[model samples]
Target chain A: MSTIRIAQLSCGTEYSGVQFEIESAARAVGAKIVYPDVSYSQVKEALDRFGFKPKSTQLQLMIARAMSLADRKFEADAVFITTCFRCAEAALVRNELRRFIQENTRLPVVTYSFTERLKAAQLLTRMEALVTIVTRKELLARERQSGITAGIDSGSSTTKAVIMENNKIIGKDWTPSGAVVVETAEQVLANAMKEAGVEMKDIEAMGTTGYGRFTVGKHFNCKLIQEELTVNSKGAVWLANRQRGEATIIDIGGMDNKAITVRDGIPDNFTMGGICAGASGRFLQMTANRLKIDIQDLGAMAVKGNWANAKMNSYCSVFGIQDLVTSLGEGKKFEDVAAAACHSVAEQVYEQQLQEIDVRHPIIEVGGTSLISGLVKAVGEVLGEEPIVPPHSQYIGAVGGALLSSGFL
Target chain B: MKVFIDPPNSMVLFDLVERFGHEPLSSMAVIQEKIDNIEVDMPPMNVTLDDVVRGLKYAGVEVPSGIRGRMSLWGPMIEAADAAIIIDNAPFSFGCVGCDRSNELTKYLIHRRGIPALTVKYPTDEAEAKIMVGQIKDFLGGLKQ
Candidate 1:
């Protein structure tokens, strides 16, 4: 039995006290700890090289420093990213950092969120479990067996599924979540399995996440059930592995708008708008219908048109539609009205969720709404920076659910 | 009639009191006004050395210096109120000022004033919320009679 070396990555100022506790826990679990030695300048340079903007929050800078150091042959068995529970920025930065480390290096990363309410015994249990998983992965790497895992994200508007084989995404599919959630979950799973050319019996482990997770999990008899925030964070990092440093995830779903701050490849802080809020896909669809245009075309039209200063102030979907009609009646260009609506949705998210917190750069916009180019542009304009929309942003949640199962396996 | 509310700065209680046709008195409002009116910039709602000494003189009881200082802020508001509503277990957000000591001191001062007071825990569910609203309506309705 070789000594398990774990690289501990965290914000030094916030978790100096917890670092001692983490060291003690690792010692109890028969593992040695290694901290990052990279300076702020080194981290900033690394982030610039990776195409991320230079300016970042303190927590994000710290996460970048950890990633930069990790990239340089750290020689650790596993990586542990701990963040203060209330520090939303750290959580988001940690997620991005985790992805950067995993993509750049073969080291398995596990994130632990530390809060005042967290007990020493509970922390030790999680630490012990992470170590066990890391040690097992090391042994399994020698003779990797072909194992398939499936994950289903049964969201309010869409049911998505992804199939993974040998720790890689093999197939993914999604469909409208109309009426029956359980049926939608089953259909999406079947679609993904069909695409992967695999049978239901081939799946070794299965997981479920999102709004209808419990119902879908019960129906599918999933081995794991995780929350939307955790799965989505994991998925965003897994999908967007190239972008380095802290990435803020703005997931505008059909019924809700979720602003997730991803620090170091882990979701640190998140805020969601009220259900059926105007800052979501449903609102955008409604606005497109009112404009007598396709929802997909709305983005392109906004981008092509000249309405940089167009403002849509209403936070209510009904009021927003009324505003759009009023603008159209006032002889405003259809594209300008559409652009204003998209911009308003972004502003609503910033005002209701992202305004209070320290939001970082390289904002990654995800979800079905992110597929709209105009909405992405509007969000970028509102945030005062271009936002990154990963390929297949719509299915990232499902991809994350699959990765969670695959990582555990 | 003036009604003092516990968890003093709550907009929910303030709105409820107004709906019941009574003037709502909150120690938080008084503290805010004092802090805002100060010519020199100072920490909001903080008890100065002068405030502590003055508070001790008015408290007329032997208590911890900190408790006496906190009491001074709530004492006047409670003394001037005709009725009181105390909400326990209010769900405060992360980093929001929901100090337990301040809440206890405010409740104690309100009780000392000997006015009609209703103590209720913050509702955890819809059923509890309905009960809470009913309790408030009943309390205020009886005051009118």
Candidate 2:
């Protein structure tokens, strides 16, 4: 495949001395940054035609370049609009240019506001996402698994592995994530292979995902290494049997949470971030440890409990656990305390994430937390609709990898 | 009725106001007038001495020429607005409005204009976008045409 040309549309990148960071980020992903060529006359014409006067000549050129891209005067695979964070006018123009390009072309667009302190590492993920959108459009479009494949998820809290043959999950295994990412991945993959009674040679293609995807992918020389947003949403819809319709996917992981809205198995919109771990699986693990029960059994305990009796704060994980301690010390029932923890997590997810999506029917909940009946129940109760917690929800990343990697086979 | 939107050239607020049957008083339109008036020899350097004097009424002489130049367009739009919608905490990309002093002065002028102004947070997702649109619809519908 040829190198993707991402049209750079921005102001002050050169002046702020961060142009090299942008170039290096694109180069790291096997892409090249191309500036849309604009003449002085074209700049003047664009300034006159755009109907907004910017004080900087660079801004005028930026407008003209955006017009050039929109007019098909420049050919590129994607568009990256950027401006300094300090420039309010540049911010407005950057957004306007992004909207203009999206309206005028089918090109994928990613916009950023950078500071002088910007690093190439900060821009790598955005560049990689753009490259994925451009290079893997066909792989992303594949709806089902084909041939024999395996997937590994080197997650933050736990590592998971899955093996599939001809669209069916043959075997899977999961364990607590280890200090050494590659060793943990190797063990999980070996365990899963043993369960499936297949040799490593039997697996035709392999894929890796999660936080340590790049490190593990490099170690294993996998066929696909993808970001969790697209891969997880794909795996989720595939597992829930909602490939043909619109559905919302919710994944509450150890450190962060994701809420994505998908249409026909392709993710059109997604929001992933957590201000605190209060809304993640790690918080629940803390809650279970405090209660002196097995993490797996906390869900059943919470089911028999009523959350209203032990209201807890859902803002910070530290404070949330503090509230749990107080509730338990105040002679609150263990069941109620457990239920409140589940309710607190559910409420936080609703407040923080669910509001970010239009929320289609049949929400498919996937993630390690999905197996906890209390969390699943709370999510359903808070959403006012039961989410379909598909089988093997904890191995979503691994399953998604296997499902997507099979397309390459 | 002319509706003013802060960041003065936001396409989203402009389209929403226009879609509901009102003129969106914005810098783009004001700039369009200056750009299209071919009587001025220079195309974009349309800020006249008279325009600079008008801008001084909104901002101080200590302010940057960029702010003063922008106020020349935004000041008139704010004065001409029958109603205004000001989006708060809008992401930099939503409408850059680059000059901080100019943005603050513009918002102050719009608030002091005493029109029925609606202030809203910029929606981060589709659900919030829907709610924002509904709020705009209600605010516009309440106006006595």
Per residue, candidate 2 scores C-alpha lDDT tens digits across A331-405 of 999999999999889977875555434578889999999989999999998888999999999988999899999
Candidate 1 Cα misplacement greater than 4 A, ranges? A1-146, A242-245, A308-311, B1-145
TM-score of chain B of each: 0.79, 0.91
Give the top-scoring candidate (TM-score).
2
Which candidate gets the maximum DockQ versus the true structure? 2
Model 2 lDDT on a 0 to 1 scale: 0.82
State the displacement of the C-alpha of residue B114, model 1, in Å, after optimal TM-score superposition: 48
Docking verdict class for candidate 2? incorrect
lDDT per residue (tens digit) for residues A1-409 in model 1: 8878877776642434566677777888788887666666766665544423212355545556566556674567777776665443454455456556655775555555565444454445345545655554432122221379898989988889989887577888898896889988888899899999999999987878877887988888887666676567667766776234677788888987667665555544455544336878888889889878889899998776555445567768888888877788888888888788888787667645563234667778888898899889988886789888887788777776666665556
| Runs of candidate 2 exceeding 4 Å displacement | A7-23, A33-76, A79-119, A303-311, A350-362, A380-386, B1-145
Instruction: Locate the minimum summed-lDDT window of 10 residues in model 2 chain A.
Output: A266-275
Model 1 TM-score on a 0 to 1 scale: 0.49
Q: Please write out the lDDT profile of model 2 over residues B55-145, one tens digit for every residue.
A: 5445433345677677888888888889999887787777767766577557756755678889898998999999999999888877778
